[model samples]
Target: MSFRLYWPLIVLLLVIPVIILVWQWRRRGRNVVMPFDHGQEGTGFWLRLLLNSAASLPALVLAVVILILSGPTRLKEPEVKRKLTNIEFCVDVSGSMTATMGEGDRYDASMQAIDEFLEARQGDAFGLTFFGNSVMHWVPITTDASAIRQSPPFMRPGRLPSQSFGGTEIGRALLACRKRLIDTESGDRMILLVSDGMSADLGGGRDIEVANKLKGDNIIVYAIHISTGEVPDAIINITSLTGGEAFAAGDVEGLKSIFASIDGMQQAEMERTAADAVDYYQPFAIVGLSLVGLSLVCSLGLRYTPW
Candidate 1:
């Protein structure tokens, strides 16, 4: 811990000792003041030391009072306030995801994994987006997790397969997710894309463009492909461009494991920052007050007297 003062000019009070010495000499009409020798034997060594300490009480009190007036403070070490990671869950709600791959359909199983992912990364901020032929924001990027918890039921598979939420359009979905992450002011950004099929929207190097956009913004993409056959090369390129990975989750258990892997990756990117210091002055003020009290008590019986 370190000490500091707000009003350092108050320490000028140390000049009190010089002023008192000068006044005492002037009042006695002496150029060189000498200690009064009573001619009797001096008191014992311990007694003389005790008497000298009593005479010094006023000076000690003055110094303490100066410190009190200066508003002294004790500073504590810097603290790490937050280690934040902003993650956007980009899940595919295409009709293909309705295929049963585990205890439930791929979509349902992925939703459950997403819920567990949120729980595992407790302190990080999260967003939720669902994509197919079109993209939709299920939850904005935020520290609150309640919105993510309620998303599975609202956007579950087999609701109503339409062009807006029924076909896998990876490029368009990634672009939309990137836009959302761009609007975020701070923190490490990530996109967790879950899809079970390839997309026409990824043709004509559109996928490459999306990947570069994500990489430029420092947005990592982690894709979980839940289909039976080999995962798409386009998906792998999109994820790896931004220092992320693509995984093929054949069943519910594989999907859960992929989510756990993403959790670890996000945590690995977490960073800590210094927090503001709290003001601490009460103890120093108390000590100064105690010195004043001691000075008053000493004055009652230990002060010098002209005999």
Candidate 2:
């Protein structure tokens, strides 16, 4: 560690010794010599040294006080800290997700992949949202991943053609997810959109509007579509507008690979941030104060007789 002074002008203290010498020389020149003696004239060298030290204690204390006023400090290196990214899983629970995409229905396969993703990314904050005709936030954005991992079992595919829970309203769902992320107001924001059907709600320029909103909030959307047909243009546009991409996964393995790809992408986003420096002047201040107090105590009884 390196030490520095805020008020380096305190270096003027180096002239104090010369000033004392000059003052003593002038005083001796003006004084008339008189033969004087004390019994201590035969004092030993050690006693004479002790007397000199006692007389010089005030100067030592003054030097320490000047050093303290200079604001002596030790410098610390800047540190890098890792920041958590906030990821909200926006899953479709409409009846269409019950359609078979692999060994199990699309909903079940997606949930499994999501669970694996959560396990792999333990350091990030995660939120869960299940959307059919309406959007439900199963878990708020939190660093605790267990809430998101345990959420899939409670959410099931709803019957289709119903206004309550069967239709795909991607627009509204996107908005809902965006609101949750905005409320968090921290970290790198992301939305993992898992769906297997085309949405009627994204028909009339709604996707563009929602994408702009997500972009405005610095939210990136990564869509994973588990479908036999091509992924919808709306999904692509929404993801691309926010600097994210849409993935088409036909099988369970493909789904896993997609999640892994996303995990890789997020890892690249982790960056080093500079941290504040720590102050290390307290101990020096304490020592300086203690020296001043000791000098006061020494002056009470320690002195030398002039001979």
Candidate 3:
């Protein structure tokens, strides 16, 4: 509720109206010769005061006009809004992903979990990338979750075109996903890596190299190993270096729980923007209009006559 004048120097013009009002109030009555002097009675004290006030209305109106011209503005309150996050799902489509986890296989459970995750995060942008020996961007980053939701059946491990797509190359897949996330100019970036096997391509410190690249761009990596075995050290290194963690999901329930945990860990952030100044001329305009009306009414009867 704070107010300021954009052109504060223009307020000096108010002195013009102030001087006129003061001179009108201080001057003595003039001695004019009348045709007949029945009684030498002057105007009553209250009536004289009323006349002075009526004359001052024009000066008051002038002051209001000057204030309006000075460009008065008020500070608007700050607003809190949720920060957007861009999530890219990097799912493994190797032949091993077809193995049973719960009632369905690992690939089915992973897609189902991903769908649930999309449901929870309504306003965020999402992308889908499937990787084996090859990398394919199934869906580009978008706020619409329907595209990612409809992607699972087409990219299932067993349904891939050739046996060449059966090998897991975690390092290559991560780099590909990183390239996609880097093109986004705004919001926080993240990659969710879902796989059941270790990558032969990530050995010989290649994991560290990829992790450093992802970290430099402020991209987080969350890995989910959907099997009974321990998660690979290379996967762990990448996730840890990029400010994320690796989870091992033994069954469908465990996988879903892991996704829930990730959701809770990375809750939507709230940010408050600085207050801005907006035009505050309504009050001054209303006052000026009211004074103009009053001045018109006073001119009809409350003015002094020339004798």
Candidate 4:
């Protein structure tokens, strides 16, 4: 906790005079000694005591008000993950992501999301891969987003059936990233594979085997399946089994919202304040006003005149 106004604390010095006055009041004599006297104390002494006690209430309350007015604030720090995220962004260049449902085709939308994802991340290292007939690595794992963006495209690998929308080799692509991401000394490591094809096998030999291996080591595998609709069982299972989420982006709009939620890559949120900080002073001020009013009423009822 910190204070914006350190000077307000000086107001408490006024209490020193009150403290001495209180002592003097406690020792002072009272008025009007009574005739009926088994245990009789003078009125002046008790009046002095009452005044002294009442005086302390307003003083303390004022002191508290001053402190509150000083603008106290507290900063809470977060525990930084011991090992930064070793993230692999594997995308399908398998050719089907090229199929269009909106202004931007599925592949274009995925790449746009990837660009946003890369821009948002803070302290983590990231890498890129594109899988068509075979796995192609765009950038070996690195923290530099600009470097990855400037690098050459993961050139479409040629094999049999070049015209058949590039054979989906998601399994091999994931496997290629496995050793590099897993063997890294980074603490929290993961893979994010994005594709539009249900035709692709996420559970193929390389994927299933590597997924199982990585899970055992606490490495997570996430998949974002983009299409005109729901993702297939193969894509869902790979993400589920490897302890990650599988989300289907219906179109560009839904994809945007999903990517907004997918901002773990973004800079740290330590400075952001809670959305619900209300000014509590209104209630306190009301209570203080009530106390002061009550004090006036009590004085009037007692008729301030000493008998």
Best by TM-score: 1
lDDT of 4: 0.65
RMSD of 2: 6.8
- Single out the weakest 10-residue window by summed lDDT for candidate 4: 265-274
lDDT of each: 0.78, 0.80, 0.90, 0.65
Q: Lowest-scoring 10 consecutive residues by lDDT in candidate 3?
A: 1-10
What overall lDDT, based on C-alpha atoms, would model 1 receive against the true structure? 0.78
Per-residue lDDT tens digits for candidate 3, residues 183-209, read 998889999999999997999999999
Q: Mind giving the per-residue lDDT tens digits that candidate 2 earns over 51-106?
A: 55666656665666666555556546565555778999999998888888677899
RMSD of 1: 4.8
- Cα shift from native, residue 140, model 4 (Å): 1.3
Best by lDDT: 3
TM-score of 4: 0.54
Winner on TM-score between 3 and 4 is 3
Could you give candidate 1's per-residue lDDT for residues 58-127 as a string of tens digits? 6666666666555555545665555677899888887888898777898888888988988888888899
The order of the candidates by TM-score, greatest first, is: 1, 3, 2, 4
**Local error of candidate 4 at 191, Å?**
0.7
Q: Backbone clashes per model, in order?
A: 0, 0, 0, 7
Candidate 2 local accuracy as lDDT?
A: 0.80
lDDT of 4 by residue, 88-107 (tens): 88877765666774685776
Runs of candidate 3 with Cα error greater than 4 angstroms are 1-39, 43-48, 55-71, 101-104, 285-307
Question: TM-score of every model?
Answer: 0.79, 0.68, 0.76, 0.54
